[model samples]
Target: MAKKPEPQLPLGSSSTLRGLTESFSFHSSPESFITSRILAFHKEHPDIVDTRAVVRAKVLNRNVAIVSSHAQIQQVLANDAAGYEAGGAYDELMAPFFPSPNLLLTDGGKHEAMRRTWEERMGSLKENVIPLVHQQTTEHFSEPSTSEIDLYDSMKTLSWKILLGTFLGLEHRDKLFETTEGLQENLLRGQFSLFPVTVNTGFWHSPRKKGKEAKRKLQAQTLAHFKEKESACPFATTDDGALEDIANHSVLFTSSLAVKALASILTALVLNLYLYSKEDGRSLAESLASESDPGRRSQRLRSILLETERLSPPIVGVMRRSTRENIIPSTGEQADVKIPKGWDCWLYFVGGGRDPAAFGSTWDAFDPERYINASIPQGAAFGSGPKACLGRELIREIALAMAETCIGLGIRMQGNIAARGVRGWLGWEPNDAVKPADWAQDMKQLPTQRPSEPVMVRVARS
Candidate 1:
């Protein structure tokens, strides 16, 4: 028998296929443009909760309709999510940058199991590692602030050190300090992906993939180091005593991916360090600066990050797909939007972070003070609900540390930096498929913690 003809997709679906194109600009690709566009659109068209636009594409996919309502976004992240498989699409799009496979790539049992492992390691880190956070930050901040310095690069150095120390628990963890330093240098250039589909597709995009490979090699040695210690005794075996949870070998392997995830965390703190140092942010920073209190600093930093996340979310939005088919629970009169299967769900973290319905009047300004006073839940920064950012503790700790260090040491920005947002692609993940020379020139600041470009800053004792 002859094969039956397959049903055709809508012509508009094919020829009219346009991804969220605005997210990726050719000539001038500043995140501010993308953020303002989507946010402005949402602000004007209140009724249309989910506006269809060409934000960016993932591999073969395009024309993603970005949604800002928290509820709409949440529906996509739900494990019982019915309409689509966001992680799958994300994996397809970003796998080249993060091929090692970790918590963010998949959903269901395996995702949960790995996530639990990661959570345990992180939760267990609070006591043992938090003190180090204080110690290092305090020491770094103790010095007098004189010359200007790239605040984010400085923080990235600290964040990288802290993460390697706490998570990897490397012996003399600072040894590998520089290893994670410039991780974001060539990484953000991947932003051109949404537009430069040709180059990014071939061997041109391989730094992140190479990083993953390096991590895999390191994992073996790392695991050997840990196993020997475990065979001798458990890491939590000390007295008076802080509990030291050894990052599992499995985590060691998964770290190949985790470090890439960390680019967002690193980038966020770096952005905020300079942003909060600005005139607009100084008010909130001033409030915390005078306190000399960790709790107060935490509160202030939370506000700053929320505002930053609202205005310049590093990961602007998370891509999610429904795991189970079901109606989303809602408060309004109408029922939840019917989510069909296999749809790409884009959560407007940037949208909800700045939602007028959620934030009310002062939604537009860069007001960190709102987080301290307003009722808007500061949940979107690391996400909320069941799948909240598991790395939230680290995000908070690192951000707080960067802020406190600035306050105590009086670290000033030697030069101006933009706390701008991200467009087509996240800036942290590298395109491993591409050769280093093919990418932009690697700029240096710190011999170890160099960023993509030389973000010039001069520094001295405060």
Candidate 2:
């Protein structure tokens, strides 16, 4: 194939269509600034709704189309959710790794069916999931809590393990943990390839293909190991009989992103919970600490996580391309702006989740307790309608357990000292330790870690 285009461009020279086609372009652009900018933008960019300027808006291509608006985002995600699809977006970007078809990124009934089947298999562990989460917590906490660990990396591992338990049904986890750990790391690293151009050196492809073959091979090995274990899983569907549908897609890659995304989101949520428990957070932690019972504490934590998701998004939002013919709705006078059949549209979910109209007065606060009487409107935090995040339960369970472990170990983002690394993607890192908290003024807080909002307590063991 001809040489792929380079990844970088001088500021202001990039076009919206070209920006989306390339990976990591936003890093140097003003969008990078928006990713780090505060809730103030929510006030500044009313049309984009809590975002940067129109110049910033025009760069993140949704579909093949080169433009998007909050209104278009609403229609793509909430209005015609089932009608619009995520496959095209996934195909152009994620196809290299997943190779096989995936439901989480696909459209229609097929996506729904795949989601349902995975849910059925995962349901077997409904009760087991929480316990496993608790166990995972204990294991993480059992280690020296004083050491500054990358909570971001740590959460990724824990989430991946939980995913393994749910997907492969591994009973004797002690022996399986290490191998799976390596595999999970390798697999998650493949997302680095999402950069489109191979120039993002620090990010695997960074500025060029440095560890290209090595990264690909490691990713392959990780999936192969997963496939082997998956075959052994009693839950595995047979290729011969009625279970053939399982063979239709690359379950390993298809499922990995959800696990990775869930892991990232869960890690950020727990960080928020830990921070919130502090005197600084919205003060939800005190109630959490007050509750001596672990189950009740977990429930309180769950509400806190959901509220955090609402206030601050893990990824901001999903990108969509208008594939079929249709005019944008909710645009008011601009409804006829002519979004031709093939174009890209970015749904501004961060603003949508925090919209005062959608989330109410405390939308910008760290009030997990506020969630009790109040209700949050539907959003694209875990995606909007059709492609809504299917691992919702799993992400919640694992995150709660992570909080449980942190409560038990007293692990925290040392030093109100926090910093963000590698674009806003590092989330927020606590300087006292390797832990990262919320980087943005995310109505969401330190990685949703914004303290002063939450309150926390520990179980006094005899």
Candidate 3:
């Protein structure tokens, strides 16, 4: 029997397509954009045994590891929690957008302290949160008419309102919304301007300068709101008997990027439902409405949400920085790869979800029943290990409730749906609708996932 040819690592290739098809190329070349480059890289490099798949690369003049294997990615995340603190390229890149030392960029004691405050408030606030989610869902999403909808835009507006009014208890929700509406765009525009190669990294230049200015303005608004003491701030003042923890307030507020994250997930859910239902000769809204038992409906909805998360995660990958030279804990064949200190490790979390070894033969297909019945290894949906996203539960509650509400209201979604972006930043682009100028500008904020073409959907009441 003839042996299969060894796969080549993504190295120098003549054609951009050839580079992406043959090996793992991270940057956007003339032949392809960043989103296509990333997708091609992931699709081709599923297994880690091929050294070419998980090889090292230089990004922004720093040593970097492009990890695709589930075990290797998990090990990197564990290593980060242990010693590889968050400060490095990502910190420098995101500094203009995020405040100094927040949860996303902090490690050790400070992160733990802040996380505790967040968990305490978020966990106990369910009574407050669930009701607010329902209220917001009704207001923004429960309309009973045949109005065309842009799922991405509509969901963002809904999530932002919930975050400000319900989660943060801000009284000036409308004013804050108008002011910070451009927040995501400014951050994305700045990141893109600084690092034209990719949407994730950037330098301290005009784009970043503009993003920082916008961020500072939002932070000031938050500060003034706190000073007024009109409403309680969840993270600012906690009942945990710990310190008054005021320093990380801006970081906490800025973490509303959770809004974008949830919006992406919900968009995927809607698209999947619309496409799949059309295949079975029954509308998703009809099927959902037919289920009279709330418990069964909830379970099915959760399964669909999980499946969407597994098949199409909102964020493509989670990044971590190595604080010191160390041996990354290994799973299979690549245990000996030594990661040098100061190197950035990119965990393709979504790639892990699609790992054939982990999920069996049907890994690529969208099958919610896999989640409902099978015991699949819980891939990094929200994330894995210590630094996993803290707002997973909040996102789940809001997304599930919104899905259930929309279905119950007999809302049917129709349009051309395509996934666009690198990693979990993939946003839905409905091809049938024309792009609006305001919508296009708003999407500039999250170019990584939100496509240049507006995602216009026809939302009709059944």
TM-score per model over all chains: 0.65, 0.68, 0.77
Q: lDDT at 143 for candidate 2?
A: 56
Q: Who wins the lDDT comparison? A: 3
Among these predictions, the greatest TM-score belongs to 3
By lDDT: ranked, best first: 3, 2, 1
lDDT of 2 at 52: 22
Q: Which regions of candidate 3 are displaced past 4 Å?
A: 1-52, 142-147, 170-173, 195-205, 235-256, 328-335, 418-452
What lDDT, from 0 to 1, does candidate 2 have?
A: 0.49
lDDT of each: 0.47, 0.49, 0.59
Could you give candidate 2's per-residue lDDT for residues 318-414 as a string of tens digits?
6666666555433222123334454555555555554454555544455565555445454346765667666566666666666666665544444
Could you give candidate 3's per-residue lDDT for residues 61-147 as a string of tens digits? 555566656666777776446757665646666666765656777777878887886677668666677777777777775466466
- Residue by residue across 1-462, what tens digits does model 1's lDDT show? 444333222112232334334333311222233344544546765553233222332213443344565554554555344345546667644544433455556565666676786676566656666666666666655666566655445654555555566655542245443443333333333321344342345555554544444444444444455555553222343432122223223343224233433444445444445433445546344456666767876777777665655554444456665443334433333224433345455565655555555655655455556678766666354555445667677656655655566566655444543312221112222223222232222321111112355355555434
lDDT of 3 at 18: 50
Clashes per model (N, Cα, C within 3 A) = 40, 53, 6
What TM-score would you give candidate 2 relative to the actual structure? 0.68
Candidate 3 local Cα displacement, residue 404, angstroms: 1.3
